[model samples]
Target: MSPCCNWMWGLSRRLVLSGRCQLSARHNVDVHRSFSSVPHPPRVCVVGSGPAGFYTAQHLLKHHTEVLVDIYEKLPVPFGLVRFGVAPDHPEVKNVINTFTQTAQSERCGFFGNVTIGNDVTVEELQAAYHAVVLSYGAEDKRELGIPGEDLPGVYAARDFVGWYNGLPYNRHLNPDLSSDTAIILGQGNVALDVARILLSPIELLKKTDITQCALDALIQSHVRRVLLIGRRGPLQVAFTIKELREMLHLPGTRPRLDPNDYQGLGDITKDLPRPRKRLTELLVKSALEEPTEKDATRWSVAEREWSLRFFRSPIEILPSKDGNKAAGVRLSVTRIEGTGDNSIAVPTGQVEDVSGGLVLSSIGYKSIPISQAVPFLPKQGVIPNSMGRVKESPGLYCSGWVKRGPVGVITTTMSDGFETAQAILEDMKSGNLNCSESRPGAAAIQKLLSLKQIQPISFSDWEKIDAVETARGLEIGKPREKILDPQEMLSVVSN
Candidate 1:
């Protein structure tokens, strides 16, 4: 028997021992020949082309000998966040596209782009067509600050700002104003640091990046010289990782403006913190307290731009200019921590301060919204309630990644999450929990449905054609690739 078949036999025995599955005479015969006796292989469809979707599909295809995986994406391209969300300078992170490409090239795997889930087809239809349907269409929405004057002209969500520079078609025309001398970012996460770095990075440094042409043009004309990253919690509770913090500390042509008061006694407690936290805190203290090297001292003496970290501050409103149209500053409430460690709470101190700035970007977090009414979702938590990747009360349907958990963790977390979901499906097949007795049409049925709706799905090869043109365009300008900034243009490229 194949390794998969062997695993199924072992799983059957384990299920029996656990008392969750009863191996009757009929079940014993069925489980023994489950892999070989099935009339057709299991067909699984993954919704979304992001890291979670590709990782889930990769797992299924690798583990199951006779499984077919189809990845559906709403855009004309594959590798969702890798193509749209990663920083332009961080091209190494985007290398995961090579792994995802290998998965898409598998004979048992199919890629269908430009196919929206809720609009193109319903979850019920997918459930009918595939033995298992996995929803990995990660969080696409942004959380708002909900403060007064949030709608001001100069205020933009960090999601939109990042998207604007990263070549997301929806934000191609963000055209953020950079005429101000100062900018305030209302979060201290890695994303907030990314935004601040891009704002302060020299034009020469940005010219070589894959950042959108429009964003580069805007940055060239930007007068912004200083940026402040505000957070409600202290340094210990910062959401950014050590690597991101180190990047900011070593950013070229800029100097750190950390307050000496913030580092008081931080070194004394470093020994009690976790390894990662301790290393991060030590770096923070060194940057703030220790003397700078000769080269850094020389660099800082003539630095033209600067960035600062401001703690115990929460934005209550975006202050408007004299004409009351664009943002003039931010009204921040002074805050006090009520507990110790990373889980400490920030309580308002009943005091307020206004920091002047012409631009404000909110980097709180990204959120997930319900894709279809059929899938059960918890709005307050911004996630689907699932135990072990299996949707509650919904057999043959599952979810992974941010939709499965909340928007947290890194790419490795999503990979592990996707693997767990695949394992759950495999276990179900072994125990006859997932009904694979019937052969489903999978992508064929989905294609026919799209044909009826007059929507043509873009294939992986079609995306390659688009990629070639973008690469060719980028080569002319000495960039990685000049991304097609409009969805319509992408479809046109695929059609040609």
Candidate 2:
């Protein structure tokens, strides 16, 4: 129902839950059903179902029993990226899902799986439905390279590619041609490493994991072995944590190569290197001293390549030779660094370059799109306009998660953001900011919009039924279950 296009888990959901109910008759006028002394709890509506939303709900439920919280998600599944964004091999990261599942199944909290405010539902309607609303929908689109040929069929945003390989339901149609002999990645973040590792992993290695059947099939037919991770900035700017970089180094068959060229202009290179880099460089130095003809220590058979991170080169154009319609290489404009480029974001522009590759991946970043009609957005920041998670322009509105902050920090940061937003809501409630005097509209109006063919929204039980089938499926594959990819299949999963 949300206007955002389907990506990882397609943002949208619908809820038809009725907790407070009453049967009306001609003379049934004893309608006041409880003691007047009991405090009328302020209701909270959480606008996302990701970790931020779930954690906030969990914290609120744990502390405040009187508050009734309703969680709204655009997706049919509840855990957002925790279910669709995590790597298949990293089952430990996936462990967080269990905690979220428990939190989602709360008595005080209601889960509205398939709904979208601003589109199927609206900010005005939400203002009428609950006392306070929290927006936690994560970033929805890929941050761009803003270079030419990005729209080429072979070129994929790292977010989309990673989503595909991870078996995220929203990206099933994305069958990236891993058949390219050489693949070039454009960033040095943790996400870039994930894409590289998965792209290089043997299909057999991925079989036991929770890779979607489609992704599994694609990996089996892949032809890529060489991955060149390109970063315009120096190695020091790489966003990957030491832990992930180390893990990449330790992948038994994955021989992570460090290009010494990245250190050429980084004065006093030994001191500039972070501990992770120093350690990685040490490993490379140790390996270089060995016989070039000598094989790796293990029999996993890692093919070696002279891949390196080239700094100060910006992509100018994507060139495709007559391998007819398929990309031949990428042409980059090399820029000269003229200052203390170390830790400086201002890149000097004046040089030019070109590098040939069989495939290209743009790992720029991700963007959070405000829903249709959810106005007052920050064009530069790509976030819904808000003050510390408080949606100021609209009353009874708030935002959290990636939608609150841009697509940058980790899940834990989102948790902190959610809690802070909830606290803000509580404070607002205490000050009598939650006045539902002139009722804007009810959930029935939202349903009326649906009946008028505005858009289809998914429901909570619909998600539960989906969860059941997917869990059973995961048991069948010896990995965690995955939701059905197509919208029809997902709807059918519950109906049949």
Model 2 agreement with the true structure over 1-496: per-residue lDDT tens digits: 1235533223222212221112112102211223323355556777778888887787766766566677777655678877777778887887877787777655555666556556566766676656676777788788887776767768888888877876565677887877677888887777887788887776667777877888878777877777887766655556666666666656655675555554544445545566766665444444334433344444324444323456666677777756647666787766654444245563547566667776898887888876656556786898888887787677778888787778876778777887887777767766767563343323344445544542444455557788788779888877667547765566556445
Our tally of clashes for model 1 stands at 0
User: Model 1: runs farther than 4 Å from truth?
Assistant: 1-38
lDDT of the candidates, in the order given? 0.86, 0.66
Identify the leading candidate in terms of TM-score.
Answer: 1
Error in Å for residue 238 of model 1: 0.3
Per-residue lDDT for 482 in model 1? 89
* 370-410: candidate 1 lDDT, tens digit per residue: 98889999999899889999999899999999999988888
TM-score of 1: 0.92
Q: Candidate 2: where is the Cα deviation over 4 Å?
A: 1-39, 264-308, 336-343, 346-349, 372-374, 436-461
